[model samples]
Target: MKQHTLPALLALSLLVGCSSSEEIVPDVPPSELYSEAQVSLQSGNWLTAIEQLEALDSRYPFGAYSEQVQLDLIYAYYKNDDLALGLATIERFTRLNPTHEKIDWVLYMRGLTHMAQDRNFMHDLLNMDRNDRDPEPVKAAFKDFKRLLERYPNSPYAEDAEMRMFALKNRLAEYDLATADFYLRREAWIAAINRCQELQKTYPDTEAARKSLAIQLEAYQQLGLQEAIERTTELMVLNPI
Candidate 1:
């Protein structure tokens, strides 16, 4: 009986040693996680870096490391082609930590994100211009530029925003002219005259206003309204574009 017990004790000791050797390893250090995130970013693995940085947020929420992680998450979102998310995160940072040294940069990035989103629509409108089409996107682009101008008046983005506004104004004028042209081609004289009149009032400085005047003249003449024709002619001359 003593010999059997000795053999069982030895077997138990071996089992304990094996269990200790196979213990599950713990997670890496916070600093190591940060380093891995940086390396992943450098390697263009933006999504992986975002995951690592996000993990550090709850674990080290008040340290310089945490702040860095939050900042890096914005860049990671941008790099990962999530511009809307990036803009929102950065805007939160700006609102919550207004005194942060990078506030200007955050503002600039937000403006850029909005501009990028606007550009896709603007590009489609410009492409449509070749076929003389809808002006909805052109109107939308102006609204985008207007926001940038009003929100970040002193931002470095202001100059670009101003330029875009100028271009958009011209595009809007052209769209009005196109609408008038469409009405004329369809023999809708009253509609054509109305579009032309709107162009004169809304965009007084555009070549579109000039073309609108010509169309308005023809529409009023076709309707044989002598006084209305003369009135539209005067308005065209007073408001050229």
Candidate 2:
């Protein structure tokens, strides 16, 4: 019995050692790793690209391909739908290389990452109102895009960022108006009026501002504030419907 048990134990130990050896991936040189990552990226294998880039970054933090590796990692994360990782990577790159020649591209990618997170495909497909959802990501995306435009007005990405910002502003304004309408429906006339005024102040040129003025007029009438009603009505008239 002891003899049989000894052989079995030896066989089990050998099996374990073989399994560990199989699991160990051979480390590639930084250049080779970067080349592999680029190939993966070109082939649209985002997860594989991410793994190779991350390994390259970790193994050669200041190597020849370090900066390019970081930038590619951000793109890989974004393509993998890892928005948080993508944003964090962008922030790190900006913080580490403040004067990077391609800083504008980084900022543009950051804005794009935020915009990707802000979109809700299912809700959009259902034709549901974005105002009913959390607006934090939308607001963050808008701010990022605004900062990109402010800092890099001549960036090749500026036009696209501006278009996205326009849509986001309207969405944000609509969200505020939706809240004000909620207050109006609840007979919270003072709160409704305050929200409308705030919306008008923040998003003056938006269609939401026009709707907000209309809401304020209704709220003022409900609260019997004749002077306020008259002021809002006059402004709405000048704004043309």
Candidate 3:
């Protein structure tokens, strides 16, 4: 439960500077403001798009393009790599418009945002493998994708969500494998074998599962358990990965 001092998380701790409630509302008309925002958005000017969109949201809170602006802002934040704001925008949109038609898309984007943040500043700072880092964000991303699939099975994002889930599953498996590898290195034979077995049972179709068999075989060999060694070797032969 160590808290990561990531760049995005640090930003989130500070106040949102451009919030409508705090900043003075611009005097531009809704159409003109929205038009400018659209131009910025179309031109790949994410910062400009955010500025214009924030202004539009502030000045004309109930404008015609309100919902579309919210959606566009989410994409803009994502493209800008502003993950914190993207998450914040998605949260607000879901809370305000829980039944919006694009809720599935929002959930998909939420998963993506979490996915993006999984490799945050800490990873780069320490050159740490993701398996050694905190797994919460990736876990959260997997859950978000799961929610999207379960609630919107017919959604266009369903296929992509499934793919993300598959990747996340392997990532989790790697985490489990890391634990088993640690126990093996420490010569905790029984614990290593138990972890490997649990990993194989949980992620039988994953590459990690196949790799776990090798670890289990090694653990059995280390402990001089001939029967377990033979069974694990057979499993490795059958898996062939």
Candidate 4:
């Protein structure tokens, strides 16, 4: 009998602990939730803003503020460093509202989000070469910026997008140069020359174009291609030093 009583007591203690540990967040009305989310955003409480915005969106999918909520969610997700969520939100918004007047802004934000994700704090702090890292996100941002410019040439965000695109183009060219250098080190002259030629064709005005031309010349010399070397030398001379 004493053993049975001890088991019952232990079960009751466990149940009490579980009940006390449960978190209880009060249910907020959609309007109140949105207001609270706005306050959180203004206060830089990204997590709280995300929570409230998500709740409002879930509760009032087609409410008066639905479109605005979606846009805000994208920005909030970006600020919270949830780049995947931010990009997903942007894609959904653009797909659903293709003709929305503020679509350019969405594209700009998408580009910014991609750029943020691509950023390497360690590389920046250590002055590491960006070309040595992954280029996918940089390429993604470049595409987004380019699309914005093509679709909305007169957009208020056009100038900034263009500037970012220029930088991204150069970065991409530098990546190709880096790869060419790697092939050159491995003595794969043909592969190195291909990469350099591709870089020159794709990013003619990039600073790396000169280096790529030089690499092509070196690869041609390494492979003992006299004709190719002469052609590359002429092209290199035509380009700025």
Error of 4 at 139 (Å): 2.4
Query: Per model, how many backbone clashes are there?
Result: 2, 0, 0, 0
Cα lDDT of all candidates, in order? 0.74, 0.88, 0.88, 0.88
Q: TM-score each candidate.
A: 0.54, 0.83, 0.81, 0.85
Candidate 2 residue pairs in backbone clash: none
lDDT of 2 by residue, 1-241 (tens): 9989999999999999998875433487787778888899999999989888887877789999999999999999998899999999999999999999999889888878987887788877997776857788888889888998999899898999999999999888999999999999999999998998899899999999898888899989988888988898899898865
**lDDT value for candidate 2?**
0.88
State candidate 3's TM-score: 0.81
Better of 1 and 2 by lDDT: 2
**Lowest lDDT 10-mer window, candidate 2?**
21-30
Greater-TM-score candidate between 2 and 3: 2
Candidate 3 lDDT, 20-43, residue by residue in tens: 445543567788888888888888
Q: Candidate 1 on 128-172: residue-level lDDT in tens? A: 443255555556556655665676578676787678777768767
Off by over 4 Å in 2: 1-26
Best-performing candidate as measured by TM-score: 4
lDDT of 1 at 34: 87
In model 3, how large is the Cα lDDT of residue 189? 90
lDDT of 1: 0.74
Q: With candidate 4 superimposed using the best TM-score fit, by how many Å does residue 232's alpha carbon deviate from the native? A: 2.6
